[model samples]
Structures are given as structure tokens and as C-alpha cells.
Target: MSEIPPDLRYGDSHEWVRAEDDGTVVVGISDHAQGELGDMVFIELPEPGMNYNQGEACAVIESVKAASDIYAPLSGEIVQANGELEDSPELVNSDPYGEGWLFRMIPSDPAQIDGLMNAEAYAGQLARILHEGGPINT
Candidate 1:
């Protein structure tokens, strides 16, 4: 079974978001996403000072089989990125929602997060996608 953290919000695109107490949000690909992508070999993260709109592509994770884009779940200014991923991309495969997080951003509008699916909804969406035999985007 894929490990789904109960506190994070999820995008239809399979990215996970965890809001920090400091107002920055942590972003990452979910376990189901890493499973579908296979072994991640490389990750390209956004620069710390970059800004992105909601749903905009901001990074890339390359696996042995495919390259996947990582989108911003909400409009935000990137405050930090996981530089550790460059040297140890496998963290994504092992602990995706924890130490494997991709970046941190200060949301342009925190309310945008209310529009994303919670853990239960995301799990249902994942189940529905699997039932429909659709490709799981990372």
C-alpha cells in the first residue's frame, strides 16, 4: 500500500502540500506518484527566490523510466528548495512526504489551499484513477 500522510493536501496531478506554521508550504510528490515513476534518479528543483503561479510547473523529477514535472499546488513565492535531493534523490522513493519534500513556498493566497483535496479525498481520487486505468501523473 502507498503511504499517504493524513495532514497533507493533494493535487490532481499527484503533488502533495503541507502547510507550515510559519506560512510556508512544503511540496512533494506522493508515494503513489513515486511508485508509478519508478526509481527517481535525478531531480531538478526551482531556485529559492523564484515565484510560481498556482498549477505552474516548477521542477522536474527524472526516473529510470520517465521524467515528470512537479507543479506548484498554489500560487506562491518559493522560499527554499531541497538541495539534498540533488545528491540523494532516492529519499523521494523512501520518504516522499517527509524528508523527501521538494520545496517550501510562501503562498500568495492561503485560501487557495482550501481548494485542494484533503487526504481522504486524495485517496479516493487515487482509487478512482486506478479503477479507470488512467496513468498516474507525478
Candidate 2:
């Protein structure tokens, strides 16, 4: 079973969001997602000042197997991106929920986050996907 951290919220698209103390939310591709993507080779992250709507494609991560888009879980203006990814894209595979975090954003409306799935709900989603046989693009 993949490790799903209890504190983060997840999107059906396999993105995870963690709220920070400074009103910014940290975003990343979940462990399940990294596993599906295989060995990550590169990432194209959004600019720090870019504004994105909920569900928008904010970045792209390419692995040995495929390229996948990373979506915004909520509408927000990007505040920062993990520049370390340029040099160490493998961090996504090594520490997906921590040092592998992709970006941080200041949400346009904090309440938008409430619509995202909690950890349990995401776990159920993952189970359903496994039962159905592998990742389903949404």
C-alpha cells in the first residue's frame, strides 16, 4: 500500500494540498501519483506570481514512463515553486509529501479548499482506482 499522509487534502486528480501557517497552501503530487509516474526526470512549475483557477494545470512532471499535469486544487496565485526540483527531480520519488512539494499558493478564496477530498475520501478513491485496474486520468 502507498503511504498517504493523514494531514493533507487530496484531489481526485492525485494532487495533494497542505495548508501552511502563513496563509499559503503547499501543493504536491501524491505518493500514489509518483509511483504511477515512475522515475521522475523533470518538472515544469508555474511562475511564482501566476494566478490559476481551481483545477487548472499549474505544472507538468515528466517521468520515464509518461508526462502528467499537476493541477491546482483551488483557485490561487502561486507564491513560490520548488526550484530544487530542477536539479533533483527525483525528490518527487524520494519524498513526495515533504521536500518534493511542488508549489505554494495563496488561495483567492480559502473556502475553496473545503471542496477538496479529505484523506479518507482520497484513500477510498485510490482503492477504487486499484480495483478498476490502475490510474485513471480525470
Q: Candidate 2 — which residues are off by over 4 angstroms? A: none
As for candidate 2, its clashing pairs are none
> At residue 24, what lDDT does model 2 achieve?
93
Tens digits of lDDT, candidate 2, 11-97: 879899999899999999889889888899999999999999998888999999988888889998999999999999999999999
Assess candidate 1 and give its TM-score to the true structure.
0.97
lDDT (tens digit, per residue) of candidate 1 on 1-138: 688889889998999999889899999999999999989999999998899999899999999999989889999899999999999999999999888999999999999999999999999998898899998766
Predict model 2's lDDT versus the native.
Answer: 0.91
Give the top-scoring candidate (TM-score): 1
Q: Please list the C-alpha lDDT of all candidates, in the order they appear.
A: 0.92, 0.91
Clashing pairs in 1: none
